[model samples]
Target: MQGFEWHVPADQLHWKRLQKALPSLRDIGVDRMWIPPGCKGMDASGIGYDVYDLWDLGEFHQKGSRATRWGPKEHLSEMMQTAQDVGIGICWDTILNHKAGADRTETFQATKVNPEDRNAAISPPENISGWVRFDFSGRKGKYSSMKYHHQHFNGVDWNETRKETAIYKIAGARKDWAKDVSDEHGNYDYLMFANLDHTNPEVRADIFKWSEWIGTELPISGMRIDAAKHYSAAFQRDFVNHLRRTTFVGNHDTQPGQSLETIIIPFFKPIAYGLILLRSQGQPCVFYGDLYGLRGGPASLSRPACSGKLPILMQARKLYAYGEQRDYFDKRHCIGFVRYGTVHYSWGLACVISNTVATYKRMYVGVKHMGEEWTDILDWCIETVIIDHRGYGIFPVAAKSISVWVNDKAKGRKSLARPFDTDIYDL
Candidate 1:
């Protein structure tokens, strides 16, 4: 039954502005802020993914990340500190999946500089820590299908075929990192992405080192495990276990394999963690990406074909996961669920209303079933916490000039549905 959600720029911003808005946001029922990892630009076509300097944010980005001008992580930390003082919980984006090439370009200047030393942290073969591609077919059991292609060059399942040549290209193995794993037809010996191999002990070590540093130093109150769907469910448990045990006291597991192998890694349920932790000492807010409906009934917000999963991992959410406050199907904007303490009310008797792209379509269908072209405001108040703004006021468009009314109430909140204002529940 918590209220609104806000996504703050993880980059630098006027701390004073955020400070000033704190009281207002609090008044508006925004309990948490999911901060971004970086402020880098990302073009949908070229970028199945985007890059950011995780450790080195010398300054803050002024514009949209998909738009440029990234800042230092310190700036974000400062804002987070302020948020804590204001009784707002902070959720930091855990961008552990991949990193930008810029940071690894110099490779290993921090280590002893020796041209012949291949073991250097920044060696040609060691482009980045934990970002190495896998040769699962050779030394270990790996599944290329597991990598999240949205961050890759082509954004498809190359791992299923396991073409060594294709693997080389995806790993960005150019001048020095190249190997003789390819054949004449340009097929891969093993298909894989530039993802960090969890099986590699050294890779695991680096991940922990960084995790401890950020968790302890930055006062990271919460986490949003990025690309959760791609990683092994068991590995997710191990990662979180390590995350939970973070003492912030020099945690670096150098033993390349089996730090805590006995424990069976649980399914990578990011939201499930929230379900458990929110009731316990762990942070309460975690986002579930449209997979709810597929598992339960209907109430997801993604296109199955869009993600390329064999079967759609999305749903057409009709009911929310709330306990007795359920809105009669047609009265709700969109359904959002929570597995709060001891409750699995999938019937969605409770609701939260917001004007989001994901919810509107489902809401529209519900509205159509109820014989209405649009919805009212009070209905939204019961369903989602309405926000008047969006990223600098620009709405998320289906295409150019096809605006979405995610943030219509805010004076400056932008909408992608420009030139043709669609009905966006103006109650």
Candidate 2:
């Protein structure tokens, strides 16, 4: 689940809030959380997008505060440790496209480019002053001693001297817009603020060093690159490769024996969520807004919590939905499949999904044990299905919904109980 929303309360002590809710989140089958950016932004209330200092991370007294919008360094560390103790992994939101709130302004030769087409230079190359120098005096070169200058970046949108707002492409030798970026606006490499020139070796080395430092400092399982399209793809690949080789970071083969399969379906409704989670494909993820309602947005724009539907589906995924599969995709609107459980997890299930009218499908669940009684674990369909001697059962699903039918006497049926029920796991 995403640990925070766009408008989560600025002073909510969100790190501690998530740490407190870790156990409950784990209980609902949330193994990892894609948390907001942990690095210090432009200010205390900055939501990490105004990337000021990556190395600070609420540690140094920079950006008008010692802590980011979420919390201080100590709280973030505590939260990460808590998540680790509770067997939940953290996916840090990494911002690498640009830097904001520079320590000082520096004079550099830059050419004003057309906003619609950055390749078309509108003005001649002239000396323009912009906030392009970052000494990070607060950090005092603790984690990384390398400071940033205009040569380290490709462009800036603002010229401090002229007080103008236009796409000013920083002009220097080997300082053109990166070619390995999106071709929009002629060249989309220059995004916002001091856009880091991935082509610069110093910039690449400093970012790689910060990536390693953050990975080792925090107990993070992975990173979600922010504004990835605005940077060099080659640099991103090399950064990941460097992390894999230098430290236990990145989403590659860092874990010894575990293969991570994540399928993040953002802003999916309950039915869509059911179709994905109750299947035999990739590991499905639950949206935080769906699982625990959204807050702080406009009242009409806010969404109430999904009415106790996701926990059941998540529980089903965790306890059952295993083994060999059989697919019945004869109809366009209706489809079904069966998982013939393995020896270790032998409480196989049959799933029927329909996007239109209510329907049923006859699917085989293996003829090994043919006389088992099956019922919808979702409790959406009250009817019970009986497997015939051929191991085929007619499973019923409601209109525009799904039904996950499992053996009525499945060994772990008790553990598939709904969340917040008093007698959950007592079935």
Candidate 1 residues 1-427, lDDT tens each? 1111122123234233344444444433345665554323222111212433333323322123322222344555566687777777666556555433321111111111122322222223222222323221221222111221212321112222223122222233221221232332332222223444444455456567667766766665677676655444555677788887874211001111223322212222322332232222343332222111111122222221112211111110111222232122343333232211114422111122233343332311111112212112112122222222230111111211111122123222221112221111111
lDDT tens per residue, model 2, 123-197:
999999999889889899898898899999989999999899999999888778878889999988888999988
**All predictions: root-mean-square deviation over Cα?**
18.3, 6.2
What TM-score would every model get versus the actual structure?
Answer: 0.38, 0.88
Say which candidate scores most in TM-score: 2
The residue ranges of model 2 lying beyond 4 angstroms of the native Cα positions read 249-268, 298-305, 420-427
Angstrom error at residue 285, model 2: 3.0
Task: Please report how far candidate 1 places residue 10 from its true position, in Å.
Answer: 12
On the 0 to 100 scale, the lDDT of residue 159 in model 2 is: 92
Clash counts per candidate, in order, are: 40, 0
